[model samples]
Target chain A: MSTIVKVGMADLKVVEYPDALTTLGLGSCVGICLYDSTTRVTGMAHIMLPSSKAIRKNENVAKFADTAITELIQIMESKGAKKTRFIAKIAGGAQMFAFSSQNDSMKIGERNAEAVRAILKELNIPIKADDTGGNFGRTIEFYSESGKLLIKTAGKGIKEI
Target chain B: MGIEFDRMNNDIIIDVLREIGNIGAGNAATSLAKMIDKKIDMKVPVVKLVDFDEVPEMLGGPENIVCGIFFKLEGDITGSIMFVLDQKSAINLVDLLMPRDNAEFDEFTISALKEIGNILSGSYIASLSGLTNLQIKISVPALAIDMAGAILSVPAIHFGQMSDNVLIIQNEFIEVLEAKSVDGYFFLIPDLDSYEVLLGSLGVTL
Candidate 1:
């Protein structure tokens, strides 16, 4: 039995067993998980920022959403996980900002979620299920053994990830 | 409109920064209080204005530090502010928001820190707008390492350093389980023309 592995914001976790990897509290930040059901390999990343342009190169590159997702895919493939079999599941992109005016440009939560969706689409990886968008935060867990996902949000009840 | 600090001396600036900290931290504390249903006692906020060179010394070696930068736009002009929090304070703050039964640092704790950063930055900008009566808009908070030399070396990286005004506010938050101290630095980096405009808005003469 693989124990629960918790990942923080701006961090990444790669495990051979999908049962071990889990991520939580996705607000404006994004939680992306790459898993291969055949090989039972899994990788998760919690990205706080969208891009790494402003950050230094020597810094931890896995903290950004774009770079982290790419890195996670590479790591999963290295563990004998096939790209064709890999599927992506994402969560946590809430419009947490309570601005009076609704400006499209200012919707970072929506933008982040959209960015992940677009990137996954470009990579040809299908997103199996996603629980994104709203005014509340979320906690997500992934099980590599069964490729099972668990999701929990305040006042929203718990569901399969 | 270069602000000649006659009325806003170093001491006065510190006082103002303290007041700002009180208001900003108070807002965050209220939210945390509501989340955990526990009251927290925050120390009197300490404020200082230091040169760019002095930033490293104040942060005490700069290891395990996290920085968040946000740009605030007021009409045509924009100003940037950075918030720096130490590792211990960051973890403690998260623990306060989401107390775990296991007493271990978990994913929930890290997420809590990010959320805390979000709340602090949001409340700080909102309080600033309320205080200055300026329609300020803030970007989402982005996290960074608090390497002092690296942060100050790149002068024009995020915000230009045309103006020599920097405000540092130190706050201590005390709860029943843990106590933590964190610093919030506000750098008013404005171009020559924008600096003048900002000063004029603040009722300071050039």
Candidate 2:
């Protein structure tokens, strides 16, 4: 059995064979889990924001949802995971802040979620299942061997994805 | 009609707010640093004093805003203070607080934001109280959808026509492991009686 590889926010980890990739405490942020069931290759990233432009250019680029997703995909593909065969499962994107204004930038949580969907669609990678959006937070675990996804939400029960 | 006070120029207000923001943010940074056993470096806060209509532009968009309320006291004087941070900053903060865990960014992280808010609000208020030698109580931070409207409405209950005067300060937080950007705003709403008291305290003759 492969050991579980845990990834933190702004970080990513990839492993081959029987290993489980996991990330926890997703709030307004997005966690993208990519798994190649045939090869048992799994990768996960906990991205904090949707865009990198809002932050300093030289900063941690992996922390942003957009760059992180692309990087995760490239890294996984480099490890012999095929892009066409990879299935994506995502979680997080809570409206942690309740104050609504007329502006769009502040709705970062929503924007992050929207951006993830848009990016995934453009890549032609089908999102097999997703748990996103709300006032609460979530934790996600992805199993590479069987492509089993376990999701735990705040004040809510665990669910299989 | 409520009496209109002379508007403070943006540059002057911003400068004053930047100084105050540094002090308040410094308190928060110290608290977090002690908790995580890491050194935090924060840039000098950027302050902006703008009309209510201009807040949207300054903040960059309309979404949920989280606020922490605190009271500051200085030598028998008391002031109500509030801190506001953007959603992105909130997420980044949660990530920094719980770095070892492999949790996705979700409600757990948002809940984590409240914890940071509590620390920041509590510590800053405590610092202000310590400096001022007065007692200050803070209300439980309420996460609301419309922050500006909520703040204006709350002050109206205690004071009439009080939303017009607001002070805002923005800052960035940086540490060796990560960096997060955030902003805070202080709204000064005084009732007719409190207004008189404030003016009196400032030694202004009505």
Give the true-contact fraction for every prediction, in order. Answer: 0.00, 0.03
Give the chain A TM-score for each candidate: 0.90, 0.90
The candidate scoring highest on lDDT is 1
> How big is the positional error of residue A68 in model 2, measured in Å on the Cα after superposition?
1.3
Chain B TM-score of candidate number 2: 0.67
Q: Chain B vs. true chain B: TM-score for each candidate?
A: 0.70, 0.67
The C-alpha stretches of model 2 lying farther than 4 A from their native spots are A100-105, B1-140, B143-206
In candidate 1, which residue pairs clash? A18-A143, A18-A144, A19-A144, A149-A161, B1-B196
Q: Cα lDDT for residue B144, model 1?
A: 41
Q: How accurate is candidate 2 locally (lDDT)?
A: 0.59
lDDT of 2 by residue, B122-148 (tens): 776666455434455554554533333
TM-score of 1: 0.53
DockQ of each: 0.02, 0.03
Question: Going through the candidates in order, what is the number of backbone clashes in each?
Answer: 5, 35
Q: Give each prediction's root-mean-square deviation over alpha carbons.
A: 12.3, 15.8
TM-score for chain A as predicted in candidate 1:
0.90
